[model samples]
Target: MGQNISFNGTTGVNNDTERRIHIPLYFRILSVIEIPVMILTLVALCAVIKSQRSAPVFVIHLILSDFIQIICKLMITSEWIREVDAIFPILPDAFDYSLIAGLYFMACVAFERYLLVSHPIWYKSHHSLKVSCVVSVIVWFVPLIFTFSKYFDSLSVPIGCLIPYPIIILCFVGTRRGLSHAISLTSLKRKLILGRLFLVLLTYTFLIFPIVIMWFFSQIFPQFMFSSFSDVLYFFSHLMFLNPIADCLLYLFMRPDAGDLMKSVCCCCRTDTHQNSTHSRDEHSRDSRATFACCVSVQNPASHSQTACSSV
Candidate 1:
């Protein structure tokens, strides 16, 4: 997932020296933060999708990709289990590729949202869970091409950076146009949805573009590959992992059913409180009525007697 700054000399002779320089503290901190964030993001995504069974298929696929990515990142950071890499030779590539796949999957999600809003009937007729599943599989496949190819492995990250520019731009533009033409939704709701999309796009670009630009230059300017510069690059590179966390927050803020999703996630806690409040209110009303009835009977005894005499 990152260039090991701790390693010195050639790959073969570097293992023993690795113990001299542990992974950077900042990298460790990012990895630790990511572990819990990834777990919570996975939980939130699953909860959201499960309760809202009609959620877009792309959402499900996106979460699945993130789940895989989190696992890979976890492995990458597992310093104690260095032997795992030996057992799983593809871990590093898998980690990088999974992260790259996420970018593509997100692009697909934007495209899906555009279609759903812009051309609902056509999207509905053509869309299937199976198609989403297939697309998810395809997104992971591209990375494996570079994973196994020796010549391409070195250039994979830079190429990944370059490859998705057009897709991302096209999807961004299409999403904007779709929102503009969305006649089915009210102005306020459409504006909110468009705003959400814009935030997601902006956050993604901000996080990803810096690393891409750095890598682009590192290819041409070997000085950009110095350890000091590499350290900075590593920091930004791992920051990409924060995208899933941002994404979950975006859903919480933007989705119309966010409150319902929260209640669903915390339904176990809400049920008792709701029931207790309703029961307490009912009991209070019943007691008040009983007290009122007793007071009325006492105060109206003379009237009751007159009514009895009239009846006789």
Candidate 2:
């Protein structure tokens, strides 16, 4: 007597023990495309950070997460002998959790910007570098716990969706509000930053939603998990990986300072190095003189007395 089995509607002649997990060829191809894009994004982000004196810590964290995800994806998509056991026991879970954690960081960044622009006084008073570092640790750690838990897939999904999705929606609404109220040059710049951020979030959400929907269905109906729909899921999964590269491009175009840094690296319209050095020194001296003048004005008792008298 013989028993027949099928998985995802595809029938194959193999014993239960012979059945093994395998990655599709197309999925592996998509990963190959994603890897180079991520590498380029990482390089661009590094260049931006190097040139900027006060780059956001979140950007650094985002890049690190992207790098880790790329590595994990490579492992997942690599060609290998399929065994009844997991090919790499840890890569799949790590990939999902790390990606989700990175999404949390992106949400935090959006929220921080919203606060900074909408409530500048409060943001300045409450924001701390040390506190940001602590929060980053918490963000990365929270997802890992779920990944390692017995209910890994079933439990992590809803929380992952709840946290970042609403936060990003709030960020979107808050930024719009901030833009409407903004009048000053600085405020306008903040609006631009928020606009770029909104684009990044929106793009990420759109690309990842297909996978989320598929995952939601899969959890409830395990039979549907790796069906024909999986081919579509793989495409979206690759698109989701493109978010980091999208982020880099968005930063380059939307942030003027970062654009200038990239341009400088490309040596666009290059001038003589000696002339550039001389010009920088001159600019520094002019800034120093202006600062000294401002200090002198503040130090003058006569000016202070005159202003006090005039006010009265």
Candidate 3:
């Protein structure tokens, strides 16, 4: 009777089980290092918001997403959670979703900077805290949809990952072009915007793009690559852990205090004495002008003094 009631062949299931790879010691070590960094980043972000009395809405969301991703990664790599993951395999999906959200938030930040540079008036009028909050909410939800759909269709995951790359590149290019023509933003402001955009682009290219490319290829040729190159894909996926650490640099770039510190450190060769000397020269020039005006006023009568002082 048991033989008569034949189940689906066991060969595919056995093959899949064999293909399952264990989390390496290196990834676990990386996760241990990442947790403290993410915590410090979160604290710094909150401190910046509190001290400045202004929240960088997109950056806040991006950091939150990174924190979530790091937590999910730690959960996945933890030995204690193996049984829970087997019972309910949701942590991996959660990690993927958080990663996607982080990508979107990065794009949002780049686009916001681009708007500020390219269309200052429009950005000033239309871009408000409320609008940013709404946009961040929307960004958070969009990934859920994609991650859910990814279970039904493998291609959806890669497509979702691929979408942000071009948006970021376009923002970086637009910002570079606008910086050349921008008159409203100061040199330091323009430099910060360009630097942030460049950093985002670089992060995506080096740390995130490899996993995306491997995922895309594995999805496209699942039978061939997924079976043959599963270990390679797993190795590339671990590279993503570096992203949250790299993201701390964004906070440094965003913080005014950090930027000032960086400038001071870079210009440490210029002595305080030189600055005092310049200040003294400026004071002497002002005093000389005042003396010249007083002499002119004294040389002329009251009626002519008004015209003479005005001319001086």
Q: What are the per-residue Cα lDDT tens digits for candidate 3 across 1-312?
A: 011100111112123432334443555677678778777877887777666733677888887888887677666556577777363267767777888899999999899988988888898889776898999999999988878886577667667877999999999999999999987777777778899999999999988888778766655555564343655555566566788888877888878576676678657747776898899999999999999988977777785867768999
Q: How badly does each model clash, as a count of residue pairs?
A: 0, 0, 0
> Between the candidate structures 2 and 3, which one is better when assessed by lDDT?
3
Tell me the tens digit of each residue's lDDT in model 2 across 1-312. 001111111222331322223434444565577667657766676676556543465665766787777676666545452242465656666766767777787787787778877887898787776767788888888776656662534645435744687787888788778767877646446545666677657766776566566656555665654435655654455467666665545545424374456557556445567678889999999999999988988899798789889999
| Candidate 2 weakest lDDT stretch, 10 residues | 1-10
RMSD of 2: 18.0
Weakest ten-residue segment in model 3 by summed lDDT: 1-10
**TM-score on alpha carbons, each prediction:** 0.66, 0.64, 0.75
Task: List, residue by residue over 1-312, the lDDT tens digit for candidate 1.
Answer: 224321111121123434324434444565567557656766665675556634545544555666666666555556665566474556656656665676776677667767767778988888776777787788778766654552444555656745665665676677678777777776555655565566557756887777777665665565546566766765566566666666555555434475555556578678889999999999999999999989988999998899889999
As for TM-score, the candidate ahead, 1 or 2, is 1
Query: For model 3, what is the C-alpha lDDT against the true structure?
Result: 0.74
Sorted by lDDT, highest first, which candidate order results?
Answer: 3, 2, 1
How does residue 39 of candidate 1 score in lDDT? 68
Supply candidate 1's per-residue lDDT for 33: 72
Better of 1 and 3 by lDDT: 3
